[model samples]
Target: MNKTDRLLAIVLELQRKEVVRAEDLATRFETSVRTIYRDIQALSEAGVPIIGAPGTGYSLMEGYFLPPISFTVQEAVSLLMGTDFIEQRFDDDYRVRAQAARGKIEVILPESVRNETSRVRKAIRLLISDKQVTPSKEKEYLEKIRRAILDERKISFHYVKKLADFDGNRHSVRTVSPYGLVLVQGSWMLVARCELRQDIRHFRLSRMTEFIALEERFERPAHFNLREYTPSDDRHLRVRLRFNQDIADKVKESNNHYIEDMEEHQDGLHVVLRVRQLDELLRWVLGWGADVIVLEPESFRNRIREEAQKMLKRY
Candidate 1:
């Protein structure tokens, strides 16, 4: 079902049932609990009169009901189009659920409105990503961490660091009190108080394995705010790339965030980027294969070559 239809159905479902657990809603709708979480949030924002009990479920306020309501064709089209962002930004499971929600919206609309929505959908083309990053292998781990955060619980996990120091150690176990999840670039990082280090640290979810929630719960800091904890800033590495016409557009496509400047040159498109890590830049350059060349910062090119040789040796 489409998001709009699911939203409407959710209202009806709540009216019929006194209280419903998020897990039950996820099962009934064939969606992730997170998706149901967001849906409940959206419903509350729209003044659906939803009240929640910590462990039990969500229920409608005693004296509330949805008034008879319907949307115009234009309204439905606008709402459906907004789901594109949800599908683009979320994981595969959420995307599939969003698509199903769209189908539901279509099913409920009158024939004339449905036909219009379909026409609008077909005529308006949208492109999110040229390549979808493989769905994270750490999906289950992410859920565990999220549950811990919500429950004010401590979590223990085995983490593999991406960069090994001179000690040549890559693995360690950590016990942390999770703060919140943040999306850094395309990576999901957990901001937490590291019991091992005795400080707050950011751990990439992708690098985490063997996650477990401990029975011990930690008191959340009174002033802690996830948005304040994980912030985007302008300070970054300055680097440039020379892209051939064959993949100049692809280079532009990859980074809309830190792109400092783009110039059309006789050779191709020249891209200037302000970035955080050279490692990430090197990987992006490799993705373009022969079509892109590093223009300066000899250090980055050297690292890329060293990594390429390492790849060759491993193969």
Candidate 2:
């Protein structure tokens, strides 16, 4: 084992009992007694309480304890909840790493702390929206995408897009130079350069049926900024809407980037948003049901009206 691992093992061994002789440690580690002495001295220098006597050998000082690497009940609950949330939402090595991290934290914690963590977690559970359904293959696709992005390699993937009125359709395989994966609204998205489109496009991970990493790699542009890329012509689109007071109060709870202004009115509230896409704005407005109304931009208002009419006909 490496020096750090050996040192940690020694500490854990000492915690179980007191006074471990240098000879025993050396024998266990297959190292010389001199090396064991050196390791102990190093630990002591690093503020470990290694007390030694001429004959009694080495021991951690009585009542000398390592700083509690403990988390508060709330902190533990948050960590567990966040880890579980990510596991459902994203696919990457980070998900497995998070599980391992949680295991390690729980293993190292004292019994009382573990019990408290468990109690808090059981008492307060995460509540995700029912509409948020993560695909089973999402993690696998994400892993391949992340590998390609990190290695600056091109990737080929078969994508399926669902249409509003038609059956889901699949496209013939295409290659792209993947730039990055974005997590937006609890869904994973990949932003990449589509060879066919000759431009960057966002692909929802759930719709990516298959992904294959290519041997070919490319250098990302030095000036490429993912944050600067937006679907709208102006990168930012201002919108105005009217909502009932009840819905207005609910909107106030959200901190989405698009929301810019909110004012109370006799009937409800007027909301102004600086958004990136009309589709996104429409989705938010529709989510509030009939409690919201589009006030400006005849084009968007007409679009919403048409979509509502379509939904009405369906019903």
Residue-level lDDT tens digits of model 2 in 8-58: 878877777777888888898999999999999999999998888897788
Computed on alpha carbons, the lDDT of every model, listed in order, comes to 0.81, 0.80
List runs of model 2 lying over 4 Å from the truth: 1-78, 92-97, 158-174, 194-201, 221-236, 249-258, 275-290, 302-315
- Alpha-carbon error at 257 in model 2, in Å? 6.9
Worst 10 residues of 2 by lDDT: 161-170
State residue 302's C-alpha deviation in candidate 1, in Å.
4.4
| Every model's TM-score | 0.57, 0.59
Evaluate candidate 1 by giving its C-alpha RMSD to the native, one decimal. 11.3
Q: Write the per-residue lDDT of candidate 1 for residues 1-315, one digit (tens) a residue.
A: 999888888888899999999898889988899999899999999878899998999999998978866778888888788677556655566678889888777788889888888888898866645443424565556667778899999999899986664598879999999988876676678899998889888898888878888999999899988767645474478888888987777767776566789999898999898876676566667877778788878998888788889888999
